[model samples]
Target chain A: MQLPFSLQPLFDFLGQFTDGPANALIIVIALIKIALIVGGLLQIIPFIILFERKIISWVQDRPGPNRAGPWGLLHGILDGVKLFFKEEITPKGVDKPLYLLAPGLTVAPAFLALCLVPVGPIIQGAHLDALVSFLRLDPSIIGPGGIISEIPLAITNPNIGILYVLAVTSIGVYGITLAGWSSNNKWSLLGGIRASAQMVSYEITLSLSIIGVVLLAGSLNLYNIIDSQAGGFWHWNVMAQPVAFLLFIIAMFAETNRLPFDLAEAEPELTGGFHTEYSSMRFALFFLGEYINMVIVSAMCVTLFLGGYHGLFPLPWEAIATWITNISPSFAGFYPWVIMASYLIGPMVIVPAKVGFFIFLFIFARATLPRLRYDQLMDLGWKRLLPIGLINLVITSGIIAIDLMVTGNGQVELATKWIIGAITLGLFLAWDLLYYSPRRKAQLEKDYRLYPKSAKKGEKPALAS
Target chain B: MLVDFLKGSALALKHMGNFIIGKGNVTLEYPEVKREQPAFFRGRHRLQRYRDGLERCVGCSLCAAVCPSEAIYLEAAENTDENQVSAGERYAEIYQIHLLRCIFCGFCEEACPENAIVMGASYELAMNKRTDFIAEKDDMLDPAEKGFGDYHEYDPYISHVTPESDKSAKGDPWAVKAEH
Candidate 1:
C-alpha cells in the first residue's frame, strides 16, 4: 500500500473489472514496458542533442541552440521531424539501392546489442523462494553442464551474451561501411575508410579491455555478472579494475565514434561522413543510430562497471520481489488475463526507467566533451589504455592470488577490501587529474599563442570580436 | 621506485576529494565567473579617438581588407573644414563590426594603420539572433567625457609606481571632452 503507486491503481482497476488479476497484470506490464522505452528515447535523444550543442558552444566560447523548446531541447525533435518531411533526395548518379539500405545498417546492430542487456533483476533469481519460474537457457553462454534455473525480466537470457555483444558490435561497422561505399561519393569513401579503420582499431582494444571483466566474472552472461555485483558498490568493477573501466569507456567512445573520436564526420572536411549523400528518413535513421549506439555503449559501461539495474540503495528491489511473490496465490484464483498482465508490466516498466538514467549520463557526457583527432585517438588506444589495461589485469590477478593464498577462497570479496579498493581508485584518479591539468593548460596556451596570426596557414583563424 | 610511486599515488588519493568534486577546476566560466582576460585580449571591436578630440581612424578600410573572416565593414567620408571629425582628410562614417561573423583573431586590430582600433577585454557578446550581433559605430564609440574611454580618466603614462594615476588628467586642458 505504501508503494506510492503511479501505474499500480490502473492495473488494479483493470484486474477487478474486465480482466482477472493474473491476465490484467501481464497486459498492463507489457504495455507500460513498451511506453517506457519509447518515451525515454524520445526525451533522452532530444535533450542529449541540445546538451551537446550547449557544451560545444561553451567549449569554443559561443552560445549554442537555446531557442527551440524549453532551453532548446526540442531542436533535435525539430531536426528529426524536418529530416523526415524533407525530400528523400537520391542523387541520380549514386547506387540508389545500397544508399537506401545503408542507414538501416547503422541502426539494426544497436538494437541487437540492446537485446542482451539486463535492465533489471530477473525476479526469480533474486527471490529464491519462487512458485512461478522464468528460466531461459542458452548452452552457448552457461556452458554444457551448467544450468541456471531462474525467473527473469530479460527478453532472452542468452548464455554466451558477452560474445554475442562483441560479435554484434563488430557487425555495426557494416552499416557505416555500406553507407560510405555505396554512396559513390569521394567524401563518403574517405569516411567509410576512416570509420572502418577506427572502428576496427578500437574494437580490438575494446574487446581486450573487457577481458579483465570476463576473467573476474568467469561468465559471459550479463545476469551472472550483475549478480556478482549484488554485494554492492565495493564489488562494482569500477573499484576493482579502474584501468579496465578507463579503457572500456574510451574504447566505447571510439566504438560509437563520438566527439574527439568523431573524425569520421568532423563536418568541415567530411561533410557528414559516410552518410553525406543521405536524405529524409534514411538520414534520420543514421542520426538515430548514432544516438542509440551512444546509449548502448553507456548501457554496456553500466553493465560492466556500474551495477546494471541494481539500485544504489537497498530498500526497493527486495521489497518489490516480496510483493510480487505474495500476489501469486491471489493471481491463481483470478482469471488468466489479470495474472498475465502483471507478469509482463512489472519488469518492462521498471526496467526501462532504470536504463534511462544511465542513458542520461551518456547524453551528459556528450554535452560536456569535445571530439578528438584521429592521431590522438590512435595514441590513446595503443600507448595509454592498452598498456594500462594490461598492467591492471596483471595487478588484479596478483591480488586474486594473494587473497586465495591468505583466505583459502579464490574470491576477492569487497566487504574485507573496500577501503583499499577505494583508496587505490581515489589515488589513480587524483594523479591523472593533477598530472593532466598542467600539461593541458600549457598545450592550450601554446595552441592559442601560435594560432591565427603566426600560423594562419591550416588553422581557421578565430573570428574577431 | 615502487614505494615512491605508491606514496605519490596515495597522496593524490588523499587530496582527490578536494579536486574533482570540490573547487579545484582550472577552467573559469567565462562571462559568468569571469576569467581575467589579458590586457590585449582582442574581442569586440570599438572605435578610437586621439587625445586632441580628432578620430584616430583615418577612413582606412585596412581592418575590413585584412579581416580573414571579412567581419568588418567601413565606409569612409571626407572630413570637410566645417564638419571635420578627424585630423586626417577622411573619416569613417559608417563603420560596423558584425559580431556574429567576427572570429576574434585580432587581425582587425593588427592591420589598423592608425592604431585606431585595438582589441579590448569586452568579451560579453552573447546574443540570441544574428541581427542583435551586428554592433554599430555608436555602440563601439569611446565615451571619453562620460569616463568610458579606452584609456579613460587614468593617466596612461603612469606605471604601477604612480598610486594617484587613477585620477583624471583634467590639468591638461586639451584632454577635456564631451561624451561620444
Candidate 2:
C-alpha cells in the first residue's frame, strides 16, 4: 500500500533526530498536516470574507473595501482586530454557561468536518523509495517491516467520511440553538428556533441529495468518491447527478444559513438572529463559524460533485514528463521528485480553484436573490426540494439496479448515465418554461383579482355603501 | 422559474461586468471629488458690492419682508455726504441671516431691489455651533476690491452663462439666464 507522493522523505528526514518508532513519526507527520491544513484554512478565511464583500459590492456596482489595503485585501484583518478589541457585552439575566460555550461549539464541528475532506488526489506510482535510498535511510526505520505505503492528503480519512461530515455539521445547529436560548432575548430565540427547524428540515434533503452520488460511487469515503470521478470533468458526479446537484446546492444554502434561505439570521425579522445578543469576540466567533461553514460546504460540494482535485481536461503528464527527460538525460535523477511534485501541487491548486468557484457562487446567490420568506423557506425545503430529491434518488437507484441486473456489471455505463442526466435536466427545464411558470403567474393574477378594484384610476375603492 | 433565476443572475453578472470594466458606477468617492451643482441651485447667500465699493443694498428691507422664514434681519441708516455707503439715500447698518432657519428658496435674491443678496454656490454650510450658522453683514459681504462681486464667479459655467455684460440685465425673458 505504497502511497503515491507520500511525505515519507520528510518523515525519514525528521526520523534522523528521533529514536522513536515509525508509528510516532506517522503521528508527528499527521500533526504537521493538520496544522498546515487548519492554519492555512484559518488564514484563508479572512481573505474569503474580503472576497465576499468585494464580490457583493462589485455585483451592486460599488467599490467595496478598497481603503483598507491594496484592493482592500487587509480589510478582513482590520475587521478581525476591531472585533477583537470591542467590549464583550454579557446581557443581564442571560444563561452564562451556554452563552460562553455556543460560539466554540459552532466553530468546532466545522473544523472537525474539514478533516474528512480530501483536497488533493492520492496519486499512485510516485514512490519515494529511490529518494529514501539516496538519503542513506534504512527501510526498517521508516515503516513497519520497512514497507513504504499509502498516505492520505487529508488530515484523516474515515471510512464513513460523508456520514461523519453530515453528523458533525448537524451538531452546528445545536450551538445556534443554545446561543439563541441562553440569550433570553426573543429575537435570538426566534433565530435559534428558525435555525434548528431549518437545519433539520433541509438536512433531510441535503442528505437525500448526496445519496445519488453515494449510490453511484458505491462508497461513502470522500476520497473513494473522488477517486470514482477521477477520469475527467464529464465523469464528475455533477454531470451524472444533475438533479441531485441542484437539490444539494439549494439544501446546502439552507443548511449553512445563507441568503434566500437564511431565515435564521434574517436581519429584518430577527435582527442579528441567534447572535443578536452576542458582541465583541463572541460575535466574531459566530461570524467565523458561519464563514468556516461556508468554506466547508463549498469544499464538500467540490468533493462530492465537482470532481475533487481533478482538472477539467486530462493532460498527458507521463508524455510531458518523458519529453522533459528526453530533452536532457541529467534531469532523470530528479524525475521521481518532479513526478511527486506534480502530483502534490496539481490537486493543491485545482481543489482551491474549484472550491473558490463554489464560494463565489455562494456570494453570487447572496447578491442576486432576496431572502426567502419563512414559510417559503420551509415550503421549498419540504414541498419542493425533498420531493425532487426523493424522485431523483428513486430514478438514480432504479437506473443503477436495472443496469446491474441486465448487464451483470454492477455499474451503470457512463454514456447511459450522461444521457439520462441530460434528459432529466432538459425535461425539468421544459416543464418549468412551458408549464409551471405561466400557471404560477395566472394563479397569482387570479389571487390578485379576488380583491376589489379601485372605482377609478388612482382613487380609493368605494366603501360598501 | 429557472429562467427567471438565471435572468436575475445574468442581470447581476452584467452589473458586475460593468463594474469591473469601470462603467455605470455613480459613486463620487465623495470627499475626494465633489459633484457639480446645477446653475440655478440655491445655496449659501452672499451680499454684493458696486464697482466703487459702495454697498448694493439701499436698506429698503424688501428681502426681510419677502423672507418666508423671516431668517433675515437688517437695520437701516441714513447715508450723508460725509458717510456715503451706498448709491442710495440709506444703507444697511446691521444685517444678518440665520442660516439654520433659512429655507434657501432664493426669494431674498429675487426680492432685493439693489441686487444686494444673491445665492452663492457654497452648499457646505456645516457649523460647530448654532450661533455660527448666522451669517453676519461682513460674513455675507463679497470680499472683492471692486466691481459688482457676483457670487457666480466661483462657478465657471454660471459665470460663462451670466457674463460681465449682463450685470444689470434684468427682466430679459429671452436672455440666456442660468437654467436649472
List chain B TM-scores, each candidate.
0.65, 0.78
Q: Give residue A388's lDDT in candidate 1 (0 to 100).
A: 61
Tens-digit lDDT track for model 2 on A302-352? 999998878897766667777778887787755665666667764478888
**Model 2 regions lying over 4 Å from their true place:** A1-24, A123-138, A141-148, A407-412, A430-437, A445-456, A461-465, B44-119, B125-141, B145-180
What global local distance difference test value does model 2 have? 0.80
Native contact fraction, candidates in order: 0.00, 0.79
Error of 2 at A120 (Å): 1.0
Model 2 backbone overlap count:
5
TM-score between model 1 and native: 0.57
Model number with the top TM-score: 2
Clashing pairs in 2: A1-A150, A2-A149, A3-A149, A3-A150, B51-B147
Off by over 4 Å in 1: A1-43, A54-73, A125-151, A316-370, A405-410, A415-465, B1-180
